[model samples]
Target: MIDCAFKLQEQAFTLRVDHRLGAARTAILGPSGAGKTTFLMALAGIKRPTAGQIHVGDQVWSDSDKRIYLPTHQRDIAIVFQDSRLFPHLTAFENMHFARGAKVTTLQIRQVIEALELDAFGHLMPRQLSGGQLKRVALARALVAGRRYLFLDEPYQGLNRELKGQIMDFVDLWCRDQVEQVLITTHLMGECSHISDEFMVINGLGPTFLGPLHELVQQESSLKQLMQIGIENSLACQVIANECDFIVAQLSATQLYVAGHAKVGEQVVLKFRAEDVVIAKEACSMTSAQNRLVAKITQIHQIDGRVLIHLDAGQPIYAEITPRALSQLRLERGDDVHCLIKSMVLRVA
Candidate 1:
């Protein structure tokens, strides 16, 4: 079991938090400047806190009241950075074993090398390694160190998807085989969600958000905002080549291109902002509203002096309504209505 409570004040930012961690893989997730790195740094004992208590099962690394502080080496924690940080002068083989005092020995090194698929590159120099190779080496180094807890501060940030998967698999397997804890941070929640036993959200510089990934994904409004949407229109979209910034999907039915995340053959619902929709209280024949969806009024709530109208668009959709409009139209639940949507509001998300 691990329980950490600490406070750190710097010239640029002030971070304070308390959390209890059990013996399982956990992730520390936050946007940029949310102190994810700072929290990990403190966990690794790289940065001592002004006040705190750090405790493991039978040991206490820090207790401000007693004026007790343990150096990083005594904390039994290993951290992997975004950069591999391997010595360029050394070969991959030498880099793994040079500092023989690592937490794991030769047998462990062999296992790590196999798990991370670094056996082929072990003989090569750091400079000869590709981005993925460097990342694998760095991971091996951390696993070879053999700590009770592992801290990864965006360790896979710069790598491509395939490469990131390779290293992430190794780490996952290692934790499964050992008695350990993991706290990693990543901006890509979709990919990271698979590797995390529990997911947490850290927003701003105060009040860290913690919960199970599934629950957070379902109930947390913040998580919805973080999601990368994939929209598959209910029409024929000819497959075009994918570009870096956006996917070029030919909507023959609509004659438009929108950015999205989709494979060769997939069916998805298109996404749009609520404000992009035009609301009408009265009935009218279908005019030239490019994408008009029929919905039933479910509920209405006032948000910031504006009405947030809930519509059951076969599915569920939200539309912003003003109080004056709601009063003027006498909108209520069970009212059938047509929503007018502009093509420009349609986005691949």
Candidate 2:
């Protein structure tokens, strides 16, 4: 278990968080400036807390009362920042070698390099590699430390859908077999939900909720709606059939066609902006929309001239529409509605 109780006081804001996280894998879900990155910095020993303590198991990383503080390099924790902090002058192989903060064997280094598919570009410098390759090299370096704790801040920020899935697969395997504790941060709720077992919702007021993903639906209905403001709605599904320009995916019992070139039986997350969803009382014929699902209205929330409708189409889905449409359609809880989606607008991530 990892315990942290800290207060950060900056010129523009004051943020406080006190919590004990026991989960093996936890995702810090928050907006861009909700102090997620700052919290990670504190836990990684990059920033000293003004008060309180940070403990991982029996090791004490920081204690304000005793003036006990360990610097970043001394801590047995590894971090992969939002930006790939690779040495521009050094080759990719050299970068990985330089991050051998712990007593890692040469065989272990070779295994990590191969696991991340970086064997081919080991001799290339950071400037010569593409953005995705650079990200993989940074990840390889962190894994070389073989630490018990790992912190990843927006690890999938620049990668394409295929690359993101590959990275996520490796991280999932690491959490299962090697890492004792892993904490990742992302502004997009849908991106990391699959890999994380639990999540903490942090906003302007700091952390508001932290618990299992299953309990999130029942315990914090309004908070979930609020978090969806800047994020797209995502549903986890498996591709059942691939038809060149589009593919059929199954989300529970409901199947929808998504425009993406995914192989059959591949797991993917379908993401679309809430505004892109069109609600209808009855299924429309001869419409240009490529996908439609019948779902029940589970929630209705009004914010900033728009009404956010939460639906249950075998799984949770959200749609944001104008207040005028809400009045015109006269939507209500428990009402059956058809959600229209254009396949082109759907992002398979």
Candidate 3:
């Protein structure tokens, strides 16, 4: 468990956050000046809060009433910065070596080096390493030092999507193996969906939301304001049945077939882009699409020569179509339309 309640007044801005989080993994998301970094700094003991207290599990890191504040290095937490802050003068091996302490064993450090695939370039200095290599070294150093919590600030800044997924997968495994809590700040929605289920969203006004991804995605206004065009419809679903490669899921009262592998009764989050949904006047049985439902169009939005249709079959779903197609089909509010969805386009998380 983690608890933090503090009021921070910076030179140009001020923020007040008070929340308790019990999730083992959480993603911190926000706009550019949302105090995401400031909140993290306070949790890591890098910044002193003007008031209130912070407690991780049974330990107290800060308490203004008691005049107690822990120093950064003494907090037993590891932080990976956006710039991959490695000692430029030291070799990669030396950089990782310096972060090792009495709490973390030498064998543990060796494990991190191998896990991050840093054995080949361990002897090279930070200046001679590639962008990916530097980032891996930074992650390895954090694992070697992090005895409790791990903090990541934009860990996927310079990497491509494929590499980002690979790095995040490894980080997930490492945290599970060590049974540690990780708090990461990321701007990419895709990474957040892949890495964490619980999240916290903050702005200049401080924390606005903190809960499961499914519940948070249901907030249309907040979701649109934070993600903008990247917003995808999310549904809390359960696997009812599986046939070969096809998995049948139930979203509220609506049942849909998806292509995935999951055990019966397993709960999952179903996500698909609005543009992938095909809106038609009637369901086409001859098509290869596996899921088709009749829904009423509740709202229609036009942007960039395209239309976004919000509908409700059982739960809310969004479908996007071109303006020309919309005109040809004559779709409007309160119109009943068939939403044809392909199983392959569905992403289960």
Candidate 4:
């Protein structure tokens, strides 16, 4: 658990936070210039807070009143900045060795290198590597360090969607097995939805909001903050079977067929953009969509000419439609609707 109450003056505003984050994995979200990076730097001990305290478990990392400040190197935390901050003169392998010192074993080093797909480029210098390769090397260094906490600041910014998904999967598995806590900062909601158990939102310099994504979606203010990046529906399900064409997962009482592979009985989260959902007043028998669920509209919110429909189909799900569709279908609160989602559109996060 991380308990923090601090204030830091940025160039534009004073970033104030008073929150206790107990989740094992937390994702930080905010718009541009919202101090998302600043908040992360403070926690990593890169920037000292102007006042208050920071406590991670039983250790006091920072306390302004006591004049006690722990340096970044002493915090037992590994951070990947927005830029791949590797040593210019060192090769990728050398950078990882430096970060791990003499403590990491050869077997552990090889495992991390393989996990991150860094073996081919390990001999390349920082200047010789591409943007995506540099990011992978930075991540490998952090993993070799074997820190208690892992902080990722927009770690997937430069990668393509397919590559981003693959690296996130690797990082998720590593965090579960090795790290005590993980905090990632990203603008895209679906990028970290699979790994983050909870979310922390920093809107400007005001108080930050922290909670499970499902709970945060219920609140209008937090929902607005999330929608800015792109609102995505994250459904927790358990894989029941893997078929020839698609994987079958059970979401409560409903069965969801998604385009992915996972072991049977493994728990997974399915994420899709709200725009991908099509709502109908009745289920069609000859539709091309692979999945359909009977849901009841619990809330209808109109934001910036778009309609956001909140539904309950054993579990909370959201869909977005234009005002024209909303009026054509005559969708209203408490009405029963069918949610049509294509299997190809669904992603296993």
TM agreement with the true structure for every prediction: 0.62, 0.82, 0.73, 0.93
Pairs that collide, model 2: none
Compose the digit string of candidate 4's lDDT tens values, residues 1-349: 8999999987797889998988889999888788889998999888889999999999999999999999999999999988989999999999998899455678878878887788898998999999999988998898888898988888888887777787888888878988888898888777663758899988765667899878887787777777776778878899999998689999877798998788899998888898899998987958889889899999998876777899998878889899999999998999999999999989987
lDDT of model 1 at position 270: 49
RMSD of 3: 5.3
* Candidate 3 residue runs with Cα over 4 Å from true position: 101-111, 218-221, 232-281, 284-349
Better model by TM-score, 1 or 2? 2
State model 4's lDDT: 0.86
Question: Which candidate comes out best when scored by lDDT?
Answer: 4
Clashes of each: 1, 0, 0, 0
Tens digit of per-residue lDDT, candidate 3, span 103-206 = 77778887777667788999998999998789889878887775688888777677664556556666877787774788888765555535475788777563
Could you tell which candidate, 1 or 3, scores higher by lDDT? 3
Residue-pair clashes, model 4:
0
Of the candidates numbered 3 and 4, which has the greater TM-score value?
4
Order the candidate numbers by lDDT, best to worst.
4, 2, 3, 1
Cα-lDDT of candidate 3:
0.78
Q: Per-residue lDDT tens digits of candidate 1, residues 138-222? A: 8677777777777777777766765565566567777777538888777655334234667666654457656664345334353
